[model samples]
Target: MVTYFEATLAQLSVHRVGNKGLNEFYSLSDNTLRIEDETLRRLLMQYFLSPFEKAYEVFRFTHSSDDLNLNELFHFSSMIFDDQSAFHNLSGQITKHLFNISNHPKIKSGELYIATFRDIQLEGELVDAIGIFKSETKESYLKVNPEEGGFALSYEEDAINITKLDKGCLIFNSEKEEGYKVIVIDQTNRTDAAYWKDEFLQLKIRNDSFNKTNITLGVCKDFITNKIDEDFEISKADKIDLLNKSMKYFKEKGSFNLDEFSEEVIGNPKAIESFKNFSREYNEEFDAGLDQPFDISGAAVKKQAKVFKSILKLDKNFHIYIHGNKDLIEKGFDEDKSMNFYKVYFKEEQ
Candidate 1:
């Protein structure tokens, strides 16, 4: 199974500082920027134009500007298009994916559990830096922040921020041999406790005992697709996007199936129609061995009456080829529920 396609490149981003003599560049709270090492902004700029970059820059500073939240940022960017879906379900392909930022935790119902260093005590040489946040809400998240001078991160008011809390903080320094301080009486559950245990383990695995970059953050995705439910996972893997296109040729001289030719993926409806009709007429005139145009009366005429023109569905990822031309996209499809043949029919201004 194919996985995620993440291309990480390290390049300098242009962040400005006032000419007052010292650097006064942007910050995430100021729009989530830094005076130096703003790699994410640079990457976004390369794909997007200057106006977009500036907008994002402004947004980062405003905090209210980002389109997606941290969990959403981590989720949508991680998946890609798949192949099996096209050959199988053949409809409603993931034309595109988007990331939406939100204030609430993406995992439905997990609040960040907060405890001050005073709340928890430390003793022996434990590995992961553990902070015991004692909040009424038993939710928690472990975020890695490099801009924080150290890898310490502190969440204030549900927003991610850099922290000065360090070894002095038990969460950042897992030197305690004893179990974590008991859960608050009001906040108690085996499931919640289990979640904390896993969080601590993942943290310890990441920063303390061993160094593993890939850590699991509890998340849930509402998988939306036109394909079968079983194939949802497969269609999201990173793979070569197979653009499918089919052309049927009909010539006058001989019934030509166009087995000798190939259709280019060039996006032009007229060019597409010209090819399909020319092939169809040519085949009718020649390949069918029809020496003359005659009236329809027999089984051949009845069969020919049902003959439908080819269809074309143009999209960002791949084109779809159904045997019959999509009169539906132009007519506006409000068809029955179970009907799954989805493709926008090219609408020409009549």
Candidate 2:
């Protein structure tokens, strides 16, 4: 549970943007370029406040001389600026645009805060990180008067509401096998989730075994819902029971054997064959494979659980849990012809 500070950006100072650099002071030249491009500005806002969100794990920054990633980043920024040398380049680029934001009609004032972590514990590992956040706040005042004609407006600083996180970015110093991982958040209009994820952070979307398993499970659910199971002449409960068995199989076994799973869960020869064909079609359609051993991800299983429902909701009265013993259940209409009923037979009431 890390806490953050919020204060008015009264002035732009070099001290706020780290001390070691050729450029140390905020000057008129810094105001030469404004953040006019909507896409770039939106990304900046997103990157600035991303670390504060709970979904992401934070880390501490390990900045010093001869940091390669930092150097590469500086080079990247310099290329963007088309400059040979950029002292205090990252902050300069960010702050100048921030200064120009005051001129925009929609944005009047903003809050800029710097975040430095001593160390961050993430997934049982501690790492260094740095973050910056810019939030747009709506400021107002309350008028109070003790005497007549002596009313004074008190600036409601405490009530200042954060309308949105205009821009933010957080950088971690921990070295991954490929590169440093970063998080960026944007609330602006022009860009989407992919723009920040792909273009700015250069993050590779996870398409691993866990993701593939989720997709395959989702395909099975689709097959059941779309009446592809009708060819097996199985009842609705039977269809759900088969799906539940499939889930249980994945949970219990390390590697999924397609033939074995089809035999055990689906049972019927026609249904098993249909399931195999469906699995093949799913693999080919989504660029995934199901033949190999893929360790199931607990997270993926939990996420897909809601989608793989095994309950039959009958009107508003009964929720039939149809995960087992489909043969004991019978579905038909009553003699009145206005009511549908499912007669369930159980050995004992547990």
Candidate 3:
């Protein structure tokens, strides 16, 4: 969704932010780094923006007070967007804000990079974007060179691997009022110390086609796997069939209609009604404002399809992958062995 083929890094400021809980302090940069070498600039661009290529889900900054100006990052980013001259100062403020939020003892101190890019291709438009990144993990690299008759080898420790970015976010300057479209990646703090996105960014998933399709598929999966068995005497093969049908529908159709999906995927009247009720309950519980008859996101379908279990494990012996034609596979119990088994029928072998 985001491309940097023609993008150029305009400004870059690096700072060191430490964990407040550990009594560490943050150090601000005196001036923005002027990258003179074109090769290093290109590599840094790749390192910063490459992770966002597959990031399709968009997010917007939100606040508990329902005020955009109240959000610190949003306001600071807006100021920087409005006036590039204030980039260094605003970037320092952003780093200070991050330091203030690093109260958890598990949070690691790292170098924070604030960069501004130009001509970033997002969706179909070329827009400038502000990037914030932090490097938390380090690696060791060995260097070898020709020295006299033999090659000398030396190693360097505590080196930042440009390939593995720890945390990063890109804020495109397209939608200024609505918090500007944002995409983030945080690979380090995935556990309880999830302050990077939740406490620091304060972002909410944009209610777009991607989120709707993702949430809809999640609701269907939960209803079929966990809730349906409670009310209906459905077999595991039937569940797999339903899941397969759901995936097929999403893959085949560009748009999603609840009524059509119910009629096609869920044929039973009572089951369809139960599914609708369960969907409503799920929406209410999670506050997922899913709109009906919305366009289906292929990326979301592709991502959610991975988690839809199509494999049926038979004890510890065989695993039946029910992809199509549930009727071809029959479940039965052997009398002598007293063990349940699955009978699979196939037309040809690959």
Candidate 4:
């Protein structure tokens, strides 16, 4: 299991600065910038610089500049950056923000580069990226031969390697449900990019209320899809109808009422009894408190909308959507038939 750290940015400052030696690859003019925010800088050092080490993962923004009108300097995105203009702007912004973080303990006096590329191959995909790099050195002992005697150890500092990049943020221009998503790495000595890239960065981030909604919705989905199916001998059609009804209840209402939902969704007394047991098990299994009321997550419903469908593929000819009114569709068998026939009725065929 991965542990998530909480961070609070107190204040921030942004400024434009001249690029010292980053003009060759970036093609950026003196329009580069440096930001100075002590609280944010300390947070970055504590959370990221104090963690493991690895080269920063780059994500390109794929959205057009027209869709990237964002007023907030720090916006969250679900996707990665794949656009040149967007990635460049994002890199410039990151460099400026990182400039003001001078007094942090872990972040020594060093040069931070915002390198840009037209298209680079990452994870088998050719995309644009703005690489964030920091230049620092580690203390090392160099052996030197003295004219009078044997070799003596000389103290020297070696350039810090990119193998363990502990503190940096790769802000991609790609827009997600929130804003532009960034791959933030805070590795100290241990390098584990996969955990940060594949798992942590992929999580949905928003306000507390938004997160509560998604968590609640996710719990419901898991319970219906896994728990209910395991213990009960309910048909697929009934399950789908029940799921649709539950989703409808969540969407139409402001909050979730446990007892009311159990009565209305399941309807059967025995099933409600079974669901209570399932609810207990579900809470334990998923670490959720579904017995309490929570505001529904509209964003989560929109995101998980496709997964809630119940489809029937008939000989690859027609796909049926049995989302509601399970009684309207009858399941019948044909003699020596490999598949069951479904008699569907609709008020309007359209």
Most accurate candidate by lDDT: 3
* Shift in Å, residue 62, candidate 3: 1.0
Candidate 4 on 97-191: residue-level lDDT in tens?
A: 44433323333434455544333332344434333545444445565767666666666556444345544554433344444444455444333
When 3 and 4 are scored with TM-score, the better candidate is: 3
Q: Write the per-residue lDDT of candidate 3 for residues 62-158, one digit (tens) a residue.
A: 8889898998889998999999999999999999999999998889999999999999998899999999999999899999999999999999999
| lDDT string, candidate 2, 1-350, tens digits | 12223211111213122111232333323322345566854454344433354433222222344353553333343343333233235545544544432332343234444343334443344544444465544457576766776766555663433445655555545454234545555556443333223333344323455566677678778777774745756566777877788788777877666787777877778777887888887777645667665667665666678778888889899999887667788999898888989999987999
How many backbone overlaps does candidate 3 show? 0
Return whichever of 2 and 3 wins on lDDT.
Answer: 3
Off by over 4 Å in 3: 285-287
Q: After superposition, which runs of candidate 4 have C-alpha atoms over 4 Å from their true positions? A: 1-194, 197-207, 285-287, 336-338
List ranges where model 1 is wrong by over 4 Å: 1-121, 124-169, 172-186, 203-350
Consecutive 10-residue window with the lowest summed lDDT within model 2: 7-16
In model 3, what lDDT does residue 66 have? Answer: 88
Ranking by TM-score: 3, 2, 4, 1
lDDT of 1 by residue, 38-135 (tens): 57444432322221111100000001223222222111111211232221111101001110111112212221221111111122222221122212
Model 1: lDDT to the true structure: 0.23
TM-scores of all candidate predictions against the true structure: 0.14, 0.53, 0.94, 0.44
Q: What TM-score would candidate 2 get against the native?
A: 0.53
| lDDT (Cα, 0-100) at 349 in candidate 3 | 100
